[model samples]
Target: MTHNPSPRSRFGIRFSILARRWRRALDAHLAAAGLTDATWVPLVHLRESGHAITQKELALLVGVDGSSLVRVLDILSRQGLIERRPDASDGRARLIHLTELGEQRVTEILKALREGEERLLVDLADSDIATMLECFDKIEERLAPATDSKDTSR
Candidate 1:
């Protein structure tokens, strides 16, 4: 007999494909600004944080490994986009800060991202957007326990 999959399984596969395509589209859109998903993701997270954060915190926020984040951070540092400052409270820790130029780049990035999102989502009605967000929120909430369990297991 041929194996069959449920709607939930198909939903998961579609969601993953959608996420990958979205990232690729954003990467292309940000190419003119010299930003890729790898680089701009960290920068956007840093800007949203509004204050310097530790590498570990950023790694978690960006859903990347520490070593991977370090490589990206090194590139950003060389580009004068970010600075790693010694944390005052913890001598062993460093806080990542966006340089003046980095802040300006992030502003431009945000504007570009907004325009891109508007273009893509323009066909969707307000209620459709709201419902999609609600569905995503519910999925995130449901996944929290699985995430927490894995984190604790490690």
Candidate 2:
């Protein structure tokens, strides 16, 4: 007889379940405002920058590859939510800018996201939430140095 392993032992499976759940909830919220999670992420980052950002920088910030970023940018541009303009210093490069519609859509989506996040953590105490956020920040900080080191070595 063959023995079966516990599903909880699989970290990827657990993470995938959590990710899908979060994305489903977020996608529903964004859909009400005529947007999807994929559309909102990049736009939110661009809005935060508040200035024209190069395509390379945007791709890095969004944690996606150049080819994938180009597809996302194309979709957003087609929807009139973003524009790609020639870079002032490097004519060969392009800068991505959010349109007014994009800005407004992001504002609305952010509000919804905040609400969704609040709902997700509704059962957790305020102190617990604060501690969770701090832990996440620490994890990011620790990982960032390793990532930088690898990039530099490459």
Candidate 3:
């Protein structure tokens, strides 16, 4: 068998390919719940928090720009899945929460995600799964400090 040393060295390229595949798989799972992978974190946060969270906070948590988050919130609201209201303490800011429909849908999305993940990782042993998650966590921990330092210098 021909060895693929190129891929072995290009970790970023391999990670990108895997990320795309993971996103595609997640999108397919989400379709059944009438949601998309983009909405997953936002909805889960709202449901789990059980209280309205600031739009800015949500944007940061989801790693999206405020304007883009505004658009997504608009669409979700129009779909009757979420609602936004003025923050009581901060009039200039808005708070976001999942509607009852949103709660139901988010629940379904979680279920779909669990099933999707199970199937996706069916070939890997439990130990492999743990190692994979740990590796990603370590990568993020090491890179985040470098990223933060660079941002501060600029």
Candidate 4:
């Protein structure tokens, strides 16, 4: 016999669809700068952080595997958007930092991204947007425990 999925599962699917759609919208906005979603995300994280960030920390922030992150970093470095340097605290570890060009690009890209998000949320009331963000934060927190458990198991 086939088992039926619960309402929560259906809601999860809808959430995923919405996320993909929004990501596509944001990607389109970043494309004008010759950047993809993958490239822009890590750069933005590093720029905002305003200091040398470890590669492992960047990978975790971007939610990408080490190999994938290495490729992404390679491309960004080739583009002169970022640089990698030996970590002061760890001889074997490398730290990533946004270059001058990267910081400039990030500033421009962040402006576009903010505009895109604002346009996307234009139809929603301010209170509704606030509530939506709070809900998203709650969902992230709820999933964190499961994610930590899985990591520990691995």
Candidate 5:
């Protein structure tokens, strides 16, 4: 007898592979500019946040632990990409701010990402993309509870 995976398992495998491939593609495209997913992702998030944010909040946004984010922030600081200042209400809490250079880098990163997306999506129809987005939204909704549970456990 031959073994076969369930639809959920098949979908999971495909999704994971696609995610990894997408990351690798982005990594390759940004390599010349010396921006990896680790460095650029947080910058983009900070730019979009539109306000001062704490280290803990940034770590959550970036999907990394607070300790790990420290190293990344250190690099960004040394490169003049970001600044950390004490929060007004809470002296112990430091708020993360993107420097002028960091904002410029985020713009470049977004442009590169848009170009990459255009190339990848060129063959797909708009309706197909819309349908895919709908399906993804449903999947995300289903996963939200599980995600929340895991976060609470941590």
Candidate 6:
């Protein structure tokens, strides 16, 4: 008798493969903007913030410790993509903001990322893409419930 893999196992394997390929392509595109995957997370957070933000807040947004986040921020600063300034209200706190050049580079990186995602799904029909999105939404809703304890009721 032949054995068949469980659906969960197949899904996990495919997800891993797809994630690696997607990240690899995205990383290459980001390199042209003088950035890397390591720098992308914080950069995205800063871009979304749209104005000067505090380092402590940025750390929370990036989900990293102060020491680690400092290293990434240093790299970005060295590249002239970001700047750090003292907070007027706080004596010791620092504020961060993306430079105009950083904003432009991020725009290019975003465009490249969109194109890469489209390329990855090029073989799928529009209907398939819609179905895949719907299934993913349902799966996420089931398995990745809201983090708030009140939402989970457990």
Q: What TM-score goes with each of the models?
A: 0.82, 0.74, 0.73, 0.81, 0.82, 0.65
Which residue segments of model 5 deviate by more than 4 Å?
1-9, 152-154
**1-154, model 4: which lDDT tens digit per residue?**
9998897778988889998999899999779767788889999889767788888778777889978999999999999999999988789888998999999989988998998899898889999988989989999999888877755423
Q: List the residue pairs that clash in candidate 3.
A: none
Q: Which tens-of-lDDT digit does each residue in 59-122 have in candidate 1?
A: 8789999999999999999999999999998999999999999999899999999877887788
Error of 4 at 65 (Å): 2.1
C-alpha lDDT score of every prediction, in listed order: 0.90, 0.83, 0.82, 0.86, 0.88, 0.81
Scanning candidate 6 in windows of ten residues, the lowest lDDT window is 145-154
Compose the digit string of candidate 5's lDDT tens values, residues 1-154.
9989898779988989999898788778887667788899889889988987988778877899999999999999999999998999888889999999988888999998888888889999999999999999999899888877766634
Q: By lDDT, is 3 or 6 better?
A: 3
For candidate 2, write residues 17-108 as lDDT tens digits: 98789989878877886777667889989998889898777777777887888889999999899999998888887889999998887888
What global local distance difference test value does model 1 have? 0.90
Backbone clashes per model, in order? 0, 0, 0, 0, 0, 0
Give the worst 10-residue stretch by lDDT in candidate 4.
Answer: 145-154
- Clashing residue pairs, candidate 2? none
Tens digit of per-residue lDDT, candidate 3, span 90-124: 78878898889998888888898889888898899
Each prediction's RMSD to truth: 3.0, 4.3, 3.9, 3.8, 2.7, 4.8
Candidates 4 and 6 compared: the better one by lDDT is 4
- The window of 10 residues in a row where model 2 has the poorest summed lDDT is 145-154
Candidate 5 yields a Cα-based lDDT of: 0.88
lDDT of 6 by residue, 27-73 (tens): 88667766677788788889998888887778766778878899999
